[model samples]
Every structure is written in structure tokens, then in C-alpha cells.
Target chain A: MTKVKVAINGYGTIGKRVADAVALQDDMEIIGIAKTRPNFETVMAKDKGFNVYTLADRVGAMEKEGIEVSGTVEEMIKAADVVVDCTPGKVGATNKDLYEKAGIKAIWQGGEAHTLTGCSFNAETNYDEALGKDFVRVVSCNTTGLCRVLSPLDKEFGVKKARVTLLRRAADPGDIKTGPINAIVPNPIKLPSHHGPDVKTVIPNIDIATTAVKLPTTLMHLHTINLELEKECTAEDVESVLAEQSRVRFVGQGITSTAEIMELAKDLGRSRGDMWENCIWNESITMYEGELYFFQAIHQESDVIPENIDAIRAMMELESDASRSIEITNKTMGI
Target chain B: MTKVKVAINGYGTIGKRVADAVALQDDMEIIGIAKTRPNFETVMAKDKGFNVYTLADRVGAMEKEGIEVSGTVEEMIKAADVVVDCTPGKVGATNKDLYEKAGIKAIWQGGEAHTLTGCSFNAETNYDEALGKDFVRVVSCNTTGLCRVLSPLDKEFGVKKARVTLLRRAADPGDIKTGPINAIVPNPIKLPSHHGPDVKTVIPNIDIATTAVKLPTTLMHLHTINLELEKECTAEDVESVLAEQSRVRFVGQGITSTAEIMELAKDLGRSRGDMWENCIWNESITMYEGELYFFQAIHQESDVIPENIDAIRAMMELESDASRSIEITNKTMGI
Candidate 1:
């Protein structure tokens, strides 16, 4: 099997994780990583025997760390089959032209979505739509979790409108200038938070509305949702349907909490290992009389990693079949 | 005219604020305040020439905080024609026995509602129902704001089922611990917070459901509400109607903010100046194509402060007509 050659354009936290993931996946190979300047991730990737490139400086930071580089960003994309643009906001839009020039298929991370030409996707929600697509925006971790849970629920039970309250952890501790570490910056889970509603605009059947508040925590997004179901159903019925998904679990408790789910992650070896995966601990989707309430913990780094990986492979046409994409995603998640 | 004697049992932040308000009202008199230990509020009230009573000795610093003082929680009920219970959780219930035994008309705050023998009461929403009634639990601030807004909207445009996500500012920064300041206490507003189905237990023709989260802020509670209206209506109509409210200012501009309203309040010479007593910044009640998306900031301290004052005067039989209650409320608010 030909190796999937890839170049990570942004070497930030998520990008670094992506580079490592590509290197570890059997069907993938890292071509090189492009950095505005040298960062620890680039150094680490270089140490792992991958090419590291600094387009801004012909003289790379590998010298400071006593390592060698191989190519420019142009060379990196020219050599790779897929380009992952994980650069920050508008920076990705500017770098996207570089990938397009090389004719390399691109997988734009959450930040680059608005600038991309193709669909915003969660593999579970819209994988088939992603097939044969040249560029795809991986949904943000919170939306990915929501789409994963809500898509099936929307299909099983007709959804009218959903009111979502996301208790979001800080993207990082220093995200604020001087606000309380305790202040909750209420916004949607996704960028331009209301864009999640716009994504629903593309679909004819679903109407999902979300509101999020950032609490002082990292590692997970907890959502308290009220679903306007088309018909009446019990919490058990909702739980049973979600529990069937290999990637999804039913915590079987009322009102899934972040602490409860976090502890579950600790119990599940996430604290020791498997920290990258979604540690959905308290996953009960309790339906009260007619509304549904549940809490979920999604690892911002890894729960969506498999989907990002899957999008790359599908864009490259290495996994062209719809069933193949689903199979690979489920297999990667070990569902 | 005889002074309508009133005594506050819990001389904390709210208790003191209430006492200050009572001292300002001409017909009402603060007979005395009963407390477990002499706190700063008690000392300040005394310094201001109001009578104060210490039910027990100061536990001292550590003992001074969170420690209960020994004495009769029931004595306040005997000391006044109308007693206000400002104690925490179960203690409020414990004091309820005193009010009932003394056969004095009593006013209970929302926290004491769990032990309330009856229903949630909002001065605007169910003030008429409270006439000639004793043992009223003033809905929590968040609930009070929500119920007040919903009452007008529901009466004008019948609602199917309403949902609200309360982003409440902490009473102040220090409100998190045993708080005079309640910061970032998620869902601190409580469940079915104010808007529950069949509110007829307290008032008739009301069926609404709500939930809340407390953010680190003071001065306002911002409610992001989604209501399913029985009849289709334009956002302008709803905006015009809500704008018509003397107490509700439709403060929603392009990007609605609670800070704007707080500034308005300050400009208006409110204690700190919060606009409209409570500011509802939602531009519309109806959605882009479906549902309602709007935000309202309810002044926890003031919006209900005037209402609480009115309820006190009316409960004490100082006013025969409730319209006079509105006048007294407006007069105290200086509107």
C-alpha cells in the first residue's frame, strides 16, 4: 500500500498532535511540517525522523536544537499527497493558496473553515457528503461531539429545534487578558459560534441552536441540551439508541456532569494514557416528559482526531468508498 | 399614621439592603433586626441609627464566617408585623415554623422555596395572586426576570413551550464562597428556575420551563431565551411590545451586551445605574426563520428590589390598591 504523505502547515498544539497521529497511522507518512518559526513540536517531529521546514527563515531553529531540515513549504506540499492547514484563522486562508498551487488535496482544520470552499463536516454526521471532496473543514471538537450525538437522535426522532448550553473549558488558561479564571465566556462551541446553526441551514430537516459559556477548565466541553423532539419518548429510549454506537456510550445516569465524566476519563486510563481520545463518562441522554438532557465530555485534542484523519484519507481518495470511510472511522475509534 | 413595623431576621447583604430600603420608605419602619452574631451589616445598620440585635456572641473571624449563632430564629417573627427570612437553605425552612407559629405574615426569598409550602411568586407575574396571601416565595432573581418578561410576552403571544439559558452575573466577584457574591456557580440559578409548567400552583394560565448558569459578574442576569410561540409573529412586533414596557428597555443593539445596560443603569443614577431596572437586549423574539433569539439582563438587586418593596407594603396592608403598589415601586426606583 502506498503511504499517505502529509505536511502539517501549523505546528501548534493540535497540529503537533496531528503530525504525530499521521506518523503513527499505518496508511500515513509525514512529509514535513511547516512552521512560521521553530516550535517544540517541530523539534520533536524532527527528532522522530520527520522533515521540519521553516519557510520564514532559511536558517531553521533545528540549529538551536542541533537538528537538520529538509524543505520549504512549497517543497513540502509539492511532495505530499495531502496538506493539513492548521494555521491560525486568516493565516490558513493565506497559506491555502500555497497548497492549491501544488494541487495537493487539503484538509482544513476548524480554524480555516470559513476560508475553505468545501463542506464543514463531522464524519458521523455527513461522511458521504465528504467523499470525493477536495477540501473539507473538520468540525470543532464541541460541534463534532454534538453532531455525533444529535445526528443519530435527529434521524431517529424528528428534531424541531435544539437549545444547547455548552459549559466550555478555556481553550487555554491564558485566553483572557485580566478576566476571572472563573469567568465563563458564553459563545457557541464552534467558531462564529452561530455557524453551527448555519451548518444546519445546509440540511433540510434539522434545526439546532447552541449557546456556550466558557468555564475555567481545559480538556473537555460539557453540553446541557434540550431537544424539541417530534414525538414523545423516554430517556431510556434515547439512551438505548445512543449506546448502540461503538464511539458513543450511555453513562445511564441522570444529568451527566463534567466532574463525573472527567473522573470516568481518569478511571478509563485517560489520565495515565489515552488522553487524546474523547472521554465521554457521564453520557446519559435523559428525556424529561418530552425534552432531552445529557452531559458529554469531549477531548478537544483527540475525540475529533480520527475524523480529521479520516477526512484527509477520503480527500486523497485513498479511502474512496463511503463504507470504507465509515469502517475506518469506527475502526480508528475502536468502536 | 402608625408605622408598619418590620424586622429582618437575617442581617446579611440582602437583609441590610432590604433594611436600607425600608428605612427610606415613609410608611414602613424597621423596628429592629435580629441576627446570630453582630456582622458588618448589623454594625452599619446600627451606625446608621437603626436598631440592631445580636442573637449570640461573635464566634470570631473563622467563627464569624459560616458559623451559625445560637438563639431563637423564631424571635424575629414575634418582633414584627411582617418578618423576612433571609437565612440559608434549610435554616429558612427552620425559620418558617417560627413565622407560622407566631401567626405573622411572612415574606420568603427564592432560596427558601424548596421548603415553601406553596408556589413560586414573582411580584409582576403573580402579585395579584399574592394579595391576601401569606408565605410567598419571591422567585429567585433569574426566575423573577424570566417570569416577568414571559408574562407579558405570553399574554400578548401565546407560547407553546419556552426555554431559557440564564447567564447570570455573580451578585459580585466575592459571591462564590458562602456568598454575598455568587460567581461562576454553574446552574446556580437552579432548575425549572422560575418558569415551570403549571405555575398555577402560584398563578394561573402560565406554563413555562427554564434553566440557568451563573457567570462571574454582578449587576445583571442575561437570559438567552428561545420561545416557541403559538402564533407566527415578526421580530419587530415583539421588539415594539417589549420596548413598550416601562420597566423593560429593549437594549439589544447589533451585538447585545449586558455591560451596555449596566452603563445605562449608572447613567440613570441607579444605585450603580442599571438601565430599565432590567435590560432585555434581544432584538427579536422570533428567529431568523424559526424560533426566538434574544437576550435580557435582569438586575437581580434592583428589578426585584422595587417589586420586593411593593410586596412588603401590600402584604402589610399599607396599600389597599395594587396600582398604588406599582407607584410605590416606581417611586422607590425613582423612575
Candidate 2:
């Protein structure tokens, strides 16, 4: 298979992780990294011998100070076949059109989905729908981690109702923007939360009620899940299946400790927001003969890494070729 | 009408409130105050012109050392025509039979109800059931506030489902025990939070799920409630009815500010737990034309104060004989 060319737009936490993962992939090559912000990560990316691109304002400053930078979004788009837009939510709505116009397939981050049209990809649950689509927006870390467990079970297990309480991070990965909720105590003003409705855009017909509390934590978002299942299965039986998933680790005894989840993420050098990479505990997932219970921890920053790799796979028109996709995932993950 | 005599079985924070409330009633008279541990409160009651009795291990301490105490359960039981068991849970289970055998009609606290009970009284919805009954356990502070507001509406308006997240206080008037929740962690478990099923023993048909978090403050408990009604009503209608109830306070534009709820609670002292005293904001109580809507916040501690007063009325046989009951409530509250 031809080597895949990948470019990460927005070299924030998630974007850079995607850049690093693509470089390790045997079948993929990191063509460019575009960042609008000045940060340690951006500086670190440049020192690593990768082609780092800066915005026009930075490029102009570099021009005066004799520092080189990529000046336009178009230049970054032209650098690779697949562009991953990791900009904040509203940015993706407009950038989705630009990427498609440049004939470069793009994967929009959770924040950008409000403007995208193609599909929302949660690898385990909706990878097939996302394949061959030009613009794929990966759902939020919490949603992706949960749907990985639920959509599959809801299809096999029959759900009566579901309730989720998301314990979120106080700040986004790095400084993005200070919204209204920053200083204020962000309480759930509406039921099911906006996260549930966002989940519905893809996994329709799921009766979900989500509530969230933004805590002072920085990396992982914890979701306490409760769902009534139609068929009864022993907790042991369900645990075994979840443990086998490639990206998911069935965390132990239901409430997986924060330390354990972080150890797994660190071992993988997972930046943040990597689907299925979020640690989920099997015991926290109580499957008591048709009654399913569990708590899932999703690394909000690194979960979308694998999806970004997949975007490059689609861009190269090798989506149906699992052999090529697997090569890319393994290479990107340095496995 | 013959006024009923009430003996306070335990002279602690709650017990004192009960005793003071009873003293204010014209039809009700406090036979005396009983204490197993003759602490400062017992002495304070005695100094304040109360007839105090003790069930301490050794009454010699009060006689010789000048520290008053109750010597035995037997003496406390014999002293009152009716005994109110405010002892802690699990511990109270052991003594239920003793209170029953003594023919000392009893009124129990919420925690004690899991072990004993004739009825869980909220006065407005279930007061009649407690009348003429031998044992009446007042619902939990959270349950008392929630049921009073929802039950009345559920009866008047068609009901569907309900969800409540309680940010409870670290202490109640007499909660000597440390808190179960150290911080705002989702009730360590991942299911529909078992607290709801416990609430169900009283309102069986209602689908109630509760998530409780304990904060450091002792002022009041706050609840964000979402319910699906069989019929539709505007936020204004809910506000009017809540304001009409003595314990429910319409604090306006959603009970968003925790500080504001405290202010309302302070101003409404004595009457603080009046049926409608706890503030529920008009804005926070969002109503949709559809079946589902949201309403938030009822100061848990003070909201139930009025009900406690009312429970005293019925416990003292002052409900049917209204004149004496009104006088009691007035004097206890200093109104």
C-alpha cells in the first residue's frame, strides 16, 4: 500500500497527538502540523524535525524576525491528503468547507461538529458509517467512550432507559477560550445535557439522560452510567467481552481508580481524546442479569487520536482495505 | 378540646426544636425533655424553665458532679405519653420494640423509618395518615421538601417521571455524625443511585432517581428537579403554587445563586421551613409546552421546619383541635 500523507490542523493537545501518532504509523507519514497558538508543545513539535506550520500573523512576525512559518490555511491543506481540524467548535463549521474544497478529507473534532455534515465517528460503534465520508466529526470524549460501551450493548442487550452524570475537567486541553462557564458554577441547566443530543445525531433512538458537573480535574472526564437492560447477563460474562476490545480496558471492580486510568493513558503516550483508549471498569459496569451498571473514564484530550489516523486512511482511498487501515493504526500507535 | 401532652425523647438540636415548637402550641404541652447524654443542651433546657429528665448511665454524676444526664431508657419511656425517637439509624432499630411495648406512642425521624414506622408524614400530603397512628416517621429533609412540592402537583397535575440531584449539607440541626460524602463526587456508585429506591417506599409509583453530593456548608440542601408531567403547566403556575405553600419560596429566575437561597432562608427564619419557604426560582423552573420540564432548589433544612411544626401539631392531637395548635406554632416560631 502507498504510504499515507497526514496533516494536523490546530496543533493543540489533540491535534499534536494526532501528528505524533501519524508519524509512528508504518503505512502513514506526517506531512505537516499547523498551529495557531504559541505553546511548549508547538515548540517541541518544531525541534522534533517535523514540518511545523504557523498562522499568517506568526509568519509575518517570523518574516520580520527571520523565522519561517506556514502563512495560510490553504498552504496547510495543500501539505497533505487528509487534514484533521482540531480547532474549537465554531471553527470547524467554516473549515469543513475549506478542507473539502481543497480535496483533502478532514476529521473534525467534537467542538467542530455543529458545522459539519458528513458523519460522527465513534470507532467501535460507527466506524463503518464514517468510512468513505469526506468530513467526519469525532464525538466528544465522554460520548465516544460511552457509545463504545452502549451502542453495541443496546443493539445486543435492549435498553429501557439510561442516565449519565459526567464529571468533566475544569479547563480544556491548554488554553482555548474562557467561555461563560469558566468562573461560574456550571450546572446542568437542561436534561440529558447537550452531550446526549449530540450523541443522538449519530446513535439515534437511544433514550439517554445526561447531567454534568465541571470539576477541577484536568485530564479525564468520568461518567457514571446506569441503564436497564432487557436480557440478564452475569457481570462476569459482560466483563469478558469488554476486556477483549483492542482499545478498551475493562477497568476492575466497577470503579476504576483515577491512578489506574492515567497509568494506561501514559503507557500509550496518549495525548487526549483517543476513542476506546479511555479506561472503563468492568465492575463499575454492573451487568446483573439484564441490569447493566458501570463507570467510564474518558481521557478528554487524547481519545480522538485513532480517529485522526483513520481519517488519513480514508483520504488515501484505502478505507475498505482493512489491511492498510490496520497497518496505519499500528504505525500511528507505534505498535 | 383537650390538648395533648408531648414528651421530647431526646434533647438534642432537633429535639429542642420539637420541644420549643410544642411549648408554643396552646393545645400541646411538653411533659418534659429526656436525654440519655445530659450534655449542655439538657442543662440549657433546664435553665430555660424546662422540666428535664435523664436516662444517663449514672444519675449520680448530675447530683454529685453537677452534670445532668438521663440514666436509662426505661425512665425516659415512662416519662412521656408520646416519645419521639430521634436516635440514629441502625441504632434505633434495636429500641423500636421497647418504645412500642411501653405504650409510649412514638414519632420517629427519617433515618429511623428504615427500621420502624406507622407513616412517613409530610403534613401537606400525608398528615392525615399520621393522625391517630401510633408511630409516625417524618420523611428525610430531602424527601420532605421534594415530596411536599411534587406530590401536591402530581395529585393536581398528571405525573410521569422525576429526577433530583441533591447537594446536601455536611450537617443537619443535630447531625453529630460525619458526612457520607466528603465532596461533590457522584454517589460513589454508578447505578440509578440507590437513594431513589429508598425514597420509593413512600411514593411507590413514582420513578425517582436521586444523586446526592455533600458539601461543606450546613445552611441548607439544594435540589435541581426535572419531571415529566402528564399535563403541561407554565413555570409561572408552578411558582404560584409553590409560593402559596408555606415551605416553598419562589426566589425568582431559577434558584441559580446558592447565596440567594441562604438569604431567603435567613429572612424566613422560624417560618423558614414553612411549606413554601425554601426558594424555587421562576427562571430555574423552566417549563416546556411538552410533558418534560425542570425546576430547581428547595432549601432542605429550613423548608421542612414548618412541616416539623405541623407534625408536632398532629402528634400532640392538636390538628383536629385547631385553636391550640395555632397558638403553639405562633409561640414556638416567635411570630
Candidate 3:
């Protein structure tokens, strides 16, 4: 079988992780990775043996750093079977023309709005919809994590309504700039923050309302979910159903905070201490008056990495089944 | 009539404004102000002709700064009939003993939990409840702003339920350390953030839920409120009701953002550009499907200043009616 050639644009947090995960897949080969700057990330990418590509203006900077530049981003996209546009939030829209010119399938990350692709993809929920599609978007990290649990829970217990409070990390750990170092801030200050609507793009029928706040920590995004189940169920029933889902972990062994969860990820020898699963606190699971309550920590940096891999497979028609795609991606990445 | 001797403990943001507001009131006398540091704020306090007091340990810092130190916080509290503990959060809980021992009534700011005083205050709703009370806690800035509008709306239209989304400032403008300089963060990541319960402390029967997120701005907190009214009302009726409120202003005439509201406050030549009113966007007021919707900006620094003044009057029994105290406080501060 011919390997699916994947070109990753933007070699920062999500881009770097997705590149590594794609490299591990048996049916995929990374053509090149794009970087806007010749920072330490590019040095690390080169050390990892991934070809570094830059914009025409930034090529001088990359060569100045003694890093080999394969070609411009436009040239990189032209060579790949699929281009994963991980450029920052709205930059994906501007890059759409290049992908269309290349005439190859492209995948965009959650940063771009759903209208850019018209179809949002989550391996567990909407992989089939993305099969053989020319363009698809992997929903954001938070939305991806939400779908991992809510979709399965809805199918199993039938969700009447879902309310989520996201205690979001101020920034990724490596990020030194972004912060409200000693404050708790409400993000949108608008009811049903966009997360709920973003989730609907993937799980359209799921009724979920999300409220989020940014605190002083840069560890992981902790979600406090309260779901009103249509069918009566016990905590054990909910636990078993969630446990059966991939990329969802029941974490409880004196692991009380998001800090400890990150420590666990590092101790587990995971790459870059990346937690690719929804780390749900086992002790927090509760069944009260037909409503299920639980807390889950989503590593904002890497939770969506696997979804990006599966999205690539689905878009390339390399994998017909989502579960098979997820299985293959997980085994290859050691997730 | 004897003046109410008011001592402000913690001469920072709220404390300084409260001191100015108190000095304006005919029935109140500023005994002194407390400061933990000899910062520029304390310098301003001295320049404003207010006496400054520090802790016994912090006396040297004040002396070194060449600012006159009146006495210790303990000594300041003893001289006053009522003490407003404007110290940072949790610090007020410790200061409660100082007020109790000094045999003076104390008013704590919203930073302290409602349980700290058992009686939470919003002058518009709970002034009578605070009458002659030895210990009363004033709710936070956001809660005070909510009460200013919600209480009057509930009385006029009979609110069934209220939902609010808070777009909170990461920090006050003077704060240089706190930030998420380029990101929006969910402050608590929990449903029905504490603001809702804080509001209940004032309007105990009203059902309200709040979700908040913090952004990079430090201008003011903007709230999007949705209320389900028991009685049907049009946008015009809701507008008229809020328009008549003492500390709530209908902001229009091309005022589109919180920064603009702050600009308006500064242009009005208000002290410190502090807006003590709930600057509601008149254009945002909407009545749809038996619910009222609008956006209001809460000046986190000054919205609670007027409430602190009213709390002192209520606690001192200087004013018998809530409206009388609110009127006196508003007129004195030019709110």
C-alpha cells in the first residue's frame, strides 16, 4: 500500500505533536513541516529528522540557523497527499487557496471555524462523514475531549442536557508570556461560551452548554461536567461506559489536581509529558438525581493529536472504520 | 447628629475609593486609612489629606517613604465607629477579630466569602438587613453590579430565572504582573461560578446563574445578562426601569466597548476614571420570548465603592431607609 504523504504547516505545539504521531502511523509519511520562525522548535524538528520548510520571507532565517530548508510552504503542500494546516487560528482561511491550488486533500485544526471546511471531524463521532472528503477540520482540543466522553455517554445513557464548566489553563507550560498569574477571569463573559457550539459542530444533536474561566495554572484544562441523563444510571454504569472509550482515562490514586496529572504524564514517560487522553478523576464521578457529575482534565496541547491522525486517515481513505483508525493510530503512537 | 467615624483598612483600589466616597458623605468622618505598604497609592492617600496607618511591622516602610504614619491598623480601628476591611481576600477573615475586639462594627469587601460575615450586603437589596449590624460583608464588584440591575428588574417584572456571562478583566490597570496578554481564559472552570451564590446572599430568592471568563484587558468587567421574567415586559419597559436606577446608567451615543465606557468615565472627569455605575448598553436591551437581554459593564474598581459607603451608613444606623442611604451615597459620590 502506498503511504499517505502528510505535510504539516506550523511546527509549534499542535503541529509538532501531530507530525510525530503521523510519523508513527504505518500508512503515513510526513513530507515536511512548516515553521514561521527558526526558533528552538525548528532546531528540535530538524533533530527529529523531519524536513523543515518555511515561508519565502522566512527561508533566510532558517538557513541562518544552519537548518536545511526543503522548500517554501507552497512547495511542501504541492508534494503532499494531504496538508494539515495547523497555522494559528484564522491563518487556515488564508491558506485554503493554496490547498485548493495543490488540488490535494487538506485538514485544518480546531483553530479555524467550522465554516472553513463545512464539516467538522471527530474520529469517534464523525469519521465517516470525513471519509474521502477533500477538507475536514479536527475540532479543538476541548471540543475533541468533550466528544470523547459526551458522544459515548449520549449513545449509552441518552443525554437530556449537558452543562460544563471549564477551568482552563492560562497557557501551555512552555509558554512564558500568556497569563493572569494570580487571577481567575471569565473568558467570553457571554452565556454558553463557544465551546458548546463548537461541540455541536461534531456531535450536532448533543445538548451541551459550556462556561469557561482562565485561572493561574498552565497545566491542563479541567472540565466539570454535569449531565442530565434521560435514562437512569448509576456512577458505575457511567464509569464503565466512559472507560470503554479510547483516549479517556479514569485517574484516581491520590491524584487530586491537574498538577499531579501532569506529573503522572511525565512519570509515565509519555512524550513531552503529553497526555493524549481525557484524564477523568475517578472519585469525582457522581450520580445525583438523574444527573451525572464528573471532572476531567484535558491536556490542551496534545489531546487532539490522535484525532488529527485519524482525520488524516479518514480524509486519505486509508482507513474505512473510525475504531480501526483510532486503534491503528493509538498502537502506532503508544497512546 | 454625630458623624459616623469610618476607618478604611487596606488603602488600595477599593479602600482608596471608599475613603474618597466616605469623605464626601456629610454623615461620615474619615478617622484614618490602613496600608500594608508605602506604595504610590499610600502617597496619594497622604496627598489627598487622609491620615495613613500601617501595621506595627510596616511603620518603617511608611517612615522611609516620608509619608506621615498616623498609627497602626489596630489603633485606627479602635478610633472608628465602623471599620471597612478592604484588605485582600482571606485577610479580612483574620481582621474580623480586630474589629470584634475593638468593639467596632466592621464592613468587609466582596473578596471575603459570604460566610465570613454571615450577612452579605448589596445596598439596594439588603441595606435594611445590615442596619446596626456589628459585622456585614459587602458582595464583590460583579455581585454589586448585578444587584443594582437585577433587584430593580425583579421587582418591576418579576424575574423567574437569571443567567449571566461575565467577561472579566484579567487585572486592574495598575497591575503589571497579572495577565493572559493574548488569550481568553475561563476563570473557575466550574458551573454556576460563585458570583451567582454571592448575588443570592443579597437577593436570596432570585434564581441566577453566572459563568465567567478572563481576557487580556484591564478596563472593566462586562456582563451579558439574560433574565426570564414572570410578567411579560417589552424592551422599552425594561429600559425605563433600569434607567431610573440610582447607580445604573444607560450608555449609548456610540459607546460600543468597555474601553469606551472607561474613556467616557475619564472624560466625565470622574476621580481616577472610576465608573461607579452599571454602564448598560442601551442598544443591547432586548425582549425576546419573555426574556430580557442586555450587556452591562461593571467597573470592578469603583462599582463596589458606593456600596461600601451605604453599608457603613446602614451598619451605623445613620440612615433608616435603603433608598435614602443609596441616594445620599450616590449624590455624595456623583454616581
Candidate 4:
């Protein structure tokens, strides 16, 4: 089978991780990476043997900075079968017309509004929805983390409602400028943060409400979740379902925090100490009076990497079975 | 006003903080602090002018270690108006018979089973239940934190049910031996971790379920709470209620994590950087579709201090009004 040509637009946090993951897949090829500047990331992308494409107007500036460029983003888009847009929030919406004009399918990040793609994708939740679709928006790190757990719970127990409080990292570790240096800030200062609504785009019927606060830590985002089930169940019953999921890892006894999990990932020789699986402390899974509660940590930089790869297979119709695609993506990326 | 003589048993963690808070109260006097051994904490207690007493059998050993003993635990109990039993876990149960034999009213920590005391105390929730009681158990740091928020929510909006996930601290900062060094561990490993039932001890009528996971930090415990209200309310409405309560401190923007909260406490010159208030990030308080949600940090080491003081006031019948007692405790302890 011929490899599906893939172009990653926006070479930053999500984009870089997704590019590495896409390169690892046997069924996918990295046609190029698009960047707006000739920064260190562009040089690193070039060093990784990925062709670096700049914006059509920025190519000259990139070349002036002594960084070699393969072509413009337009050229890369035209050459690739599908493009994954990992640009900063809202930028993807602007790039939609360009991808549509090129007649190439595209994948957008969670930062992009869901309306930009009309369909939000999560491999575990709504993989089939992306099949044969022209564009798909992979939900944010927090939303993807939620779907990984909620999808299975909804399927097995039937969710009545879900309330999630997201303890978000202030900024990506690599980004030095973003705050909150000394305070926890609520992103929206409103009820039902955009995350729950984002999830609805993928699973329309589930009732979820989310409130988010940004913490000063950059290691990972912690989610405290409570799901009201359709019927009564034991903590063990809920654990059994979460334990069986491929993307969900039950962190038992010894592993305590996201810091320890990250250390374990490094010790396991994972690239950049990235843990692609949602680390849900097994002991934390509790069921009481018809509700399921648990605490899970998400590696913001890498948890969505596998989802992006799954989305690629989804958009191109390269794999009809989500499980099969997820399995392949997980195995290839060492998730 | 004649000051109530208070004996603090167990001179570590909660015991130490309770002793300090009790000392701050104009109506209470720390008669002595009980310690099994002459450790550094015992020395520190003595340096603070607290009368340090050792177990009868360890009195000689304590004296030999250059620690001056004011009296034996038995003598301290017999002389005090009320003995606060801060002994570790099940040990409190063993000491209960001693307190009863001495005819001294006693207060126990949350670690002790609620059955041991017959009355569990959260000043805001059950100050009246504790009034004139021979024995009272102050709920755990986590439960104390929950009650501070839930008591108000239940009173104003009428809570139908509450689900809380406690992100607990692995150990108190001063303790070197306690974990979890590298992982998040769920204590009890069962549904409705003892916390929910513990809360029932304070507010018997409110429906609440709690699950707890100990993270790798000793700074503080974070609670993600969802309360299902009997009627609809807005986030601002819920914030207004929490703000009116003295123990619930609304942490607005610019204060990001527990680490920062601790820093602010230090900047404010709090002893040991203790924050008695439940630091609820104001912006995090949100209500959606008749359900309320928010994130709050509990300074595990110090939050229960004020509750312990209030417990003493209630047990002695010195303060019949819960609000009045809470106000005095909070004002005196710099909560």
C-alpha cells in the first residue's frame, strides 16, 4: 500500500509532536512542514529531515535567515493529499479557504473553532465521523483527554451528565512568554468553559459541563472529573472499562503525580519524555451512589499527537476501523 | 472572661497548627502539648512558650533529651478544660478512653473514625451539634475544605448532591518520610473515599460523595467540586454566596496555583505560611444548567486549625453562634 502523503502546517508544540508521530506511521509520509518564521523550530524540522515550507511571502525572509526552505505552504498543500493545521488558535480558520481551494483535506487543532471544520474528531469518540470528510478538527488537549475517558464510560454505563474542572498548565514549557506567573486564572470566567461545548461537537448527545483554571505548572494538566451514570455501578466496574481502553493507562500504586509519570516516560526512553496515554491513577477511580469519579493527568504536548495521526487516517479513509487505526497509531508512536 | 484551658495531644501536623490557633484565641489558653517523644517538633513547641508534656513513660526520656516537660499527658488531660486529640489515625481511639477517664471533653482529628467521637465538627456546618458535646472530631483537611464551600451552597441554593475529587498533598512539607515521591495514589482505593462519609458527620442532611488522590506535592490539596443544586443559579450568584462566607477566600486573577497562594500567605507574614481559608479561585466558580462547579485549594496543614479552635469553643459552649465563633476564630488566626 502506498503511504498517504501528509503535510503538517504550523510547526510548534502540537505541530512538532504530530509531525514526529505522523513520520512514525508506516502508512503515512511527511511531505513537508510549514512555518511562518525561520526560528530554531524551523531549523530543527529541517534537521529532522522534514522539508520546511514557509508562508508564500515569508520564504524570502526565511532564506535570509540562512535557513533553507523546500517551498511555500501553498506549494506543500498542493503536493500533499492532506494537511494537518497545528497553527495557533484562530489562524486555522483563516487557512481553511486555502486548503479548500487546493482540494486537499485538512486537520485543525483544538485551538481552532469547531465551526472552522464543522466536525471535531477524537479517535476514541467519533473516528467514523471523520471518514471521507474534507476537514477534521482534533479537539484540544483537555477535550481529547476528556473524550478518552468519557467515550468509554458513555458507551458502557450511559452518562447522565459530566462535570469536569480542568487544572490547566499556565503555558507549554517551551513557551516562555505566556503567564500565569503567580496566579490561577479562569480562561473564560464563565460557566461551561468552551471545552464541554467542544466535546459536544464530537459526541452531540453527552451532557458535560466544564470549568477551567490555569495553574502555574507546565508539566501537565490535571482533570478532576465526575460523571453521573444512567444507572448504578461499582468503582470496580468503572475501573474495568477504563482499564481495557487502549489509550487510557491506569496508574497504579507507586506512580503519584504527573511529575512522576513524566519521569517514568523518560526512564522508559520515550522521546522528549512524552506520555501519549492519559494517565489515570487507578486507585483514584471511585464510584459512589451512581456516580463515577477519577483524577487523570494529560501531557498537553503529546496526548493529542496520536489523535492527530488517527485523524489523518480518518480524513483520507485509509482505515475504516477506529480501533485498528488507533492500535496502529499507538504501536507506531510507542504510546 | 475566663480563658478555657486547652490541652493539645499529638504535637505534629494538625496538632501543632491547632495549638497555635488555640493560642491566638483570646478565650482559650494552650495548657500544654503532648508528645510521645522529644523530637524537634517538641523543641519547637517549647520555643514557642508552649508547655510541652510527654507520655508518663517517656517523661524521663524527654527530660534526658534536654526537653523540659510541663506535665504528663494524663496530668495535662486532668487539668485542661478540653483536650484536643490530634494523635495519629487509630491511635486517637486508644487515647479516647484516657480523656474520658480524666473527665475532659476531647476533640479528635479527621483521621480518627467519626464513630470514635459520635460528633464530627465543621464549624460552619455543625457548630450547634458540637455545642456542649463531650467529644467531637474535626473533619479531615479535605472535608473541612469541602464543608466550607458546600455549607454555603447547600444553605443558599439547596444542594441536591455533591461530587468532589480531592487532589491531596502527598505529605506535609516538614515531614521527610511521607510520600508519594513519584506517583498519585488513591487512599482507601474505594468509592466515596472516607471523605464523603466524613462530611456526612458534619452536615448529615447534605448528599455528598468524595474521592481522593494524593499528588507529589506538599504545598496544598486542590478540590474540584460539582454540586447539583435543587434550583437554577448563575456563576455570579454562587460566587456571591461563597464570598460572603468568611472561611472561603475567593482567589481572583493573578494568583494561579497553590504555590502562589502559599507565597501570598508568606507575604502576608502568616505563621508557617499557613492559610486557614479555603482559597477558591474566584474566576473558577461557575454554575451551569442548575449545577455549580469550581476549583479550590486547601492548605492541608493549616485549614483545619480554625475548625479545631471553633470545635473547642463549641465543646465548651463558649460560642453558641457558629457564625460568631467562626468570625472570632478567623479574625484571631488571621484566616
lDDT of 3 at A88: 91
Give lDDT tens digits, candidate 3, residues B1-335: 78989999998888988998889989998999999998899999999898999999999988988988999988998899999988898888998777888899999988898888889998888789999899999898999899989999999988897777677887898999986664444445534467888899899998876656665678888776777799887889988998898888987776656766888999999999999999887776776445576778888999988888888888888888999988888787877
In Å, residue A318's CA in model 1 sits off its true spot by 3.4
Q: Residue A280 in model 4: shift from native, Å?
A: 4.8
Top model number, DockQ = 4
DockQ-based CAPRI category assigned to the predicted complex of candidate 4: acceptable
TM value for model 4: 0.85
The prediction achieving the highest TM-score against the true structure is: 1
Error (Å) of candidate 3 at residue B88 is 5.7
Poorest 10 consecutive residues of model 1 chain A by lDDT? A183-192
> RMSD of each candidate?
4.5, 5.9, 5.3, 4.0
Q: Score the docking of each candidate (DockQ).
A: 0.19, 0.15, 0.08, 0.26
What TM-score fits each model?
A: 0.85, 0.74, 0.77, 0.85
| Residue range A42-129, candidate 3, lDDT tens digits | 9999999999899999998889889889999999988999998889999888999999988989999999989999999888988999
Q: Which candidate, 1 or 4, would have the higher TM-score against the true structure? A: 1
lDDT of 2 by residue, A161-217 (tens): 776666666565454463222111235654436877777766878877666655434
Fnat of candidate 1, please?
0.03
